[model samples]
Target: MAHRRPATGRVSTLSEAKASSRAARSRQLCRSRRKAVSCSGAAARQSCSRATWTWSDYALEEAGRLTHPLRYDAETDHFVPIAWDEAFERAGAALRSVADPNQVEFYTSGRASNEAAFLYQLFAREFGTNNFPDCSNMCHEATSVGLPKSIGVGKGTVTLEDFDETDAVFSFGHNPGTNHPRMLGTLREVSRRGKPIIAINPLRERGLERFQDPQAPVEMVTLGATPISSAYHLIKVGGDLALLKGMMKALFEADALDMAAGGAGLLDREFIHMHTSGIDALRADIDATDWDAICRVSGLSRDAIESIARGYWTAPRAIFCYGMGITQHRHGTETVQQMANLLLLRGNFGREGAGICPVRGHSNVQGDRTVGITEIPTEHFLERLDRAFGITSPRAHGHNAVEAIAAMRDGTAKAFIGLGGNLAVAISDPQTTFPAFRKLDLSVQIVTKLNRTCLLTARESLVLPCLGRTEIDVQASGRQAVTVEDSMSVVHASRGMLKPVSDTLRSEPAIVAGLARAAVPNSVVAWDELVADYDRIRDKIEEVFPDFYDFNERVRVKGGFRLRVGASQRQWDTPDGLAHFLVTELPLDVEREGHPYLLTTIRSHDQYNTTIYGLNDRYRGITGRRDVVFLNADDLRELGLEHGDRVDIVAGERELRGQTAVAHDIARGSIAAYYPEANGLIALDEHDHASGTPSYKSTPVRVRRAA
Candidate 1:
């Protein structure tokens, strides 16, 4: 798995003269990309993983940073600066007061580094609980749960290098320009070479239409934007499962016709016979599926679905890329499983140009989980962790975000500790989530900036300032480097060039060690020793998770290293040592309940998660506004509403009132609103049953004209 990186995540074989220019530009693009589009701080750790470099909307994240520890004073209704010693003591007391370790909910964000996440989990498990709820659970949990069930691994099979060999790229439910602009360089190359880049999403995003490469000087001087999508098809929100089944059905029907005519079938019979299981069940389901039902649910005609199938069948090697749009639904797990099924039909596994790419948003959300930030730990993992730490860690299943909310609301959980996210606004049903958080005995936020979540006071609340990503961390071992794993499973070192925001600000690892030392004084985990030297922590991680063997040596290498992905070589690690074709029935419909429309949550160009950098959404052409709902122009007139009418976004008993409605190019029954704000109408309990991910992308709602 140890290898040098090229312009992409994989090696490229471009013409000699072009390679030099492309490589230089790629280096420049990734460097500036991080500086321009980063909220997750950039560290000083040396890395050559060009594809992993990310940056976006940086000013708001760095502005008004927290420099000192704060304690909430209820009488004054404000936070006053307190010394770190008192903050740690109060936090230790609060954690100690909880009768059971399970009564504490430990939360982690995607921005947390691998070293810090490892230490955080070790500290929590040492205290006798695995109550770890991470940000991945809110975003890509379906991919984590569903992909492994099919492909034997949860990570993407193809690196950016695969883009070189791919004949086509299929994009689903994602906006590359706003969310992950780094990918645009790869997509731009694909389009310029006359390869098809098919886009399927409910909203007509500007990113999918055309893109101007800031790195391409020729294109820049001409001011010409290259066409990105060969065809942009609008699929109804929450209708992916239905659309996927229909696509499969079209292929299956075509195969039957071809076989009857004494021609070879379209499906890869050899791959099916040699490498996969559960084909009969899948074939039966596709055959039995009614076309009428498919058309009704998918919101696409039979001809439209068949045309997409034609495009897929013609491409010899294609990469399927997706984002939260495919995962944030009630049936999100099944939808992800079907994506694999469609690819398996053409034998796309292990090919250079073809594989499923679950395009993750956060830089190290994947890394956090890799270093054991999961609430549900494998039995083997727990056994090794206990053996390494010399303590009996708890085996009971812990609370996720939903269960954590329920526990806190029912008074079963008493304490909360957040590593880096805005849990208060991040949690849905603010009417309920806000109060449940307030009732907690303790709440601690280890953050770099002051956010709304820090203001959600409990009986004891502390805001502890910590080091951000783009800052130096001079520890006992001198300037230290932390490691992070990108979506492609590339592990790289990251160190910040910027100095500390304040002399008082501590690193997250240091803060966690302080809390651990005070809370569990005699724990054998050796929190202090691990915090002082991150290399020792890496060694410990390598001992526990052998996937990271020789971690310290490999991480320091240029471009870092690639963790072994068995599925990349067609080495299936499933129970029977083969990939699977899982089958799940499509629901009768994505019912709107009492509402006549469906709402999907989105992020603007000027926004990242809960942070709003500015009011304008450049791509959508909205100025000084975040309270606009995007609806189809035809649907707007049908509902007796104009393009700029003020309406109440309602979901039964909940309402986000007086929101300005803006007509746009979305599907007929589908509407779009910015997320973490539209969350008011979404219930905390409403999420995928298996992965526990909120239905952020597909929520049924009604919009009524306001007085």
Candidate 2:
């Protein structure tokens, strides 16, 4: 793909000239590397390093564009091209066949724009069902569930500007280089400015260690990679709860010591007394937690815990940023609360550079929820939506992603309509999930490209290809732009610049409008009119969601506007009108005596969620294969296994056979494997009790040498 950069002048800036030279040298290096490596299959592409063009990237460029809708023929076990009219006719007929609206489930991906998501949930509500199972339920549901109870909001309060003033940044359970590449640039600047960065994860990620931004010519050409993490801790999988508690225990001791010496306490006593509640209970819990148990469970020494506490205690402003590692667990909600608790102890909220940041997985996952794609809708939101659309929205709570899967398995749900996601592959226990798709009466996917989810094939399955993010979307009102909310509370308009890959493909809003018109022929809302102009959709959205009062006008601005974050302004929207601290228990129930190893599923450098861009995990030095399991050298010795040995991973009643094991720098007694492939080992039932988010980060397993 050609990069969109500004034109250089005859006499270029020193930085620009350096960047140009580095870019030229990088291209030369790629050509030389191409001669030495073979980029053929998808697996090979996945294993190829980022500098080299992988087979999958080449395939996408080489293969002609897909320009038609497909219908799955179960009898022939193949996908056959079908006209748009036939595809919609069959999908509409299937929806009509459903005896009750509750039998149909609408699953949405984070990739869907705000315009599309708003229309989708609105249509589902009009159809008289709240069965909105979304992508957030699987990833950051913990943040959504826990942060609201703590800070009165689900989103990260800090913006891109906040990072500039932060004294310290705590990174927990996330890899910035691959998951969010743009973040690496911010981290590079932070490091250069002499701020302390503490990285906490089971594996020592390369991105956290050092970074060389190609966009900066001097850094890339001079090999002057900025060092990131000042302190790195390898906390055990499922040990975040223990680690957090240990840090708090250390902080309490420090506070007491300082107070006895006629000095102010380490904690912000004013913030706790004025803005928060339940500190006594939290203090009692921390006092009761034994240091020996904390060390054993966290896999960190008491001294190390104290050092972590000292860093936070000394920093004027610190930001706690976490990813799926903290959320994809049995006690994901509690873990999130603990992070919030740590931040609140230091008066992090309402500050310019300090806040709890949940690094979201997708670009617009937060936006989807903000625009009302939730199973559990607020009464106020429902009332407003009802008032705006002249229809009574459902009050009863509906199924989340996990519950949706169970609903399908038990035949409670018959029809499934996916709005831009590979639900089957991304979900756990594919052994049962794949068969559940077959049992569905109808399955329809709105996608930009073919994926495994489309091939699962229900009795009547239709694949309606849609316009991608890079393509221009032309509606009845000519060109249109869609809005998306980033991880922070900022909402902005996204206008596609490239031409459409195919004229047959439609925008997400157009397809959703088509389905809505067919599914509810006599609907009170004008579906066609809404799609005609996206501005009208934003107007309706403002009517339903009060936060976006001047949605259309404000969104047209260059940088857009930020939603009202109460916690950011020292205003809490809780029942007591104050932030609250909650006490949490450790996840001792997740421990298994029989299974000595804790397995965490991770994504490769070449992949984004389930989308495979190549075969290489360049940062981790992984190349040419995705079947290797990362293990500690000592653990390998104890298990009587060596590097290159084939092993079978057994978790509960399921087993993944013939995976090669390689010794690495991961925590002892914990193993790491690729996601989706390792997802089969995670049971559908094993999830956080509070959030219903799958425990993908910490699964107890036993490894055996495969014959």
Candidate 3:
């Protein structure tokens, strides 16, 4: 069981003694695992286990605090500390140098707050461009693009309360323990009730198998781990589309036999006729999908696929949950629609404990989009913004992450302003992106800690330090609390309790206000007044998005409030005012000749996105290194290789050499490696045409002996 220091405010002397004793035991355990007798004292380790290290551990122990603003010196090829005024001046000049606002791209990270994101888009539109390349383009763009076409909303409809009554949960392509630890408690309770949890993924994660809650003292101290999944299915890379179709086919076949016997069918006929359209086309497409092809592509027997279908049929209420694994594919958007189709088949919308749940990562990614941080903005949102701020906003569509990178590569984009994320490393094809970034005339990074992206210097780069979520944010108005929307669309306030790491650190809102004032001086929006109090910002947001009426008051309530979703009420906002079942064609390029192995990039357990906490992945049983690839032992035997053999991977024109291959329980013909490092294997152009999301989960690669 993993040990975490409980946030019990202050500790007593007894608490300190217990913590010291626990720390000593932890250090001894680590030493025993490594078979070393010598010790390095208590300064060598933190409170958590080797796998789970808190953010403070990373900031204090790994990467030191970034306390001042920095600028890149071209002559010296290094970063030097500079004044905030000078950094903003350089950033503003670069923004002004571009003759066309379309040539300047603004990127945002998911960690930013609602107030910051709203101001960012307002500034961009006022500056005469909409080139908003955000982190969502690389992660959940499929959900944003597909769900709107199918159910008239892009977010999940179920709330936390719905979990109590849920009969079954179908989890796909996400590891809750590492990615979203908070969800493990919910799943742990759900599992204790003996509800069925069907897990589908290429890798058999330890978290999904068992979890010991640190919050529960007995569970942690007694080593009582609760079982999470009732059954775990290993799907092949890029095989979700076939597997989903197979489940629906089995259900449809069962319904047909029931109807022939003069009995009521499994499907909701009245709901289908009244609330949905294009069923005939969808049915025909599903019927046309051959079982043999489904079995071959999905790497599952017919019986296994039907067994999953049986769970879906038996459950009166079910919630289908998925993550990036379902979205990071060439046909990711279509795959999302299929999941919606399955839910709609049973009239799951607007019902208790039932809906499509796309579990989002990051703290407020959903809220950021809700507040209008998108490349493609609707005309209604633009018109409202123009009316509210009395500014003529840009009506042209903007570049997504992929397009923004290409623009930088071709020298079309002159400047890049990042709000929070490590954009280059987070996106695919770093080999091309790294060079493209160097060609940029200006690059600005608003961050709290040093990262690989901060080090990637441009002609004129600025690394501006900002207050993190854990620090108090004080502006002209007074102390402030920013709001973040969860994966379930619950908007809540997050107040910082700890003091600032550095007195020089500024809030994201203050930083954006400074940039906006210098960049676009003529804009009529009261940038300073908006930043004075977050209530005024919420008011402006409410003015633009009427769905958030009484935003100031509603956000103050406990657990906050939920944004208006038409599909949650069974009110389809599609073109025909009805949910449509989309007919999709399976991707033809799923399998490649010679490139028999499909390599997927994954994050280590000790890392969050691109922020490496330590050189370890305890759940996967890896330590002290990330330059290794996980492969099935049978695949190694077939290739005439051993577990620790050195290999070079080739994907299309990109190559990653000398990666150590480790035998694991991953699917046959599939391989996994730590991300950002393996990002070079993914090509820039290889992405979903509809969503522009890179195929990060399934890149066809050839592994050979490293000569």
lDDT scores of the candidates, listed in order: 0.84, 0.84, 0.83
lDDT per residue (tens digit) for residues 96-192 in model 1:
8889999999999998999999989988999989998888888899999999999898888988889989989999899999988999888998999
RMSD of each: 10.9, 9.0, 8.4
Model 3 C-alpha lDDT per residue in residues 566-641, reported as the tens digit of each score: 8989999898899988989766578799798888788889898888776668888765566678888798788877
Error of 3 at 665 (Å): 1.2
TM-scores, all candidates, are 0.91, 0.91, 0.91
lDDT (10s digit) by residue, model 2, range 34-110: 32222223322321222222223223322233456777655544455678878888988899889989999999999
Clashes of each: 14, 9, 0
lDDT for 297 in candidate 1 is 83
Give the Å shift of residue 293 in candidate 1.
1.1
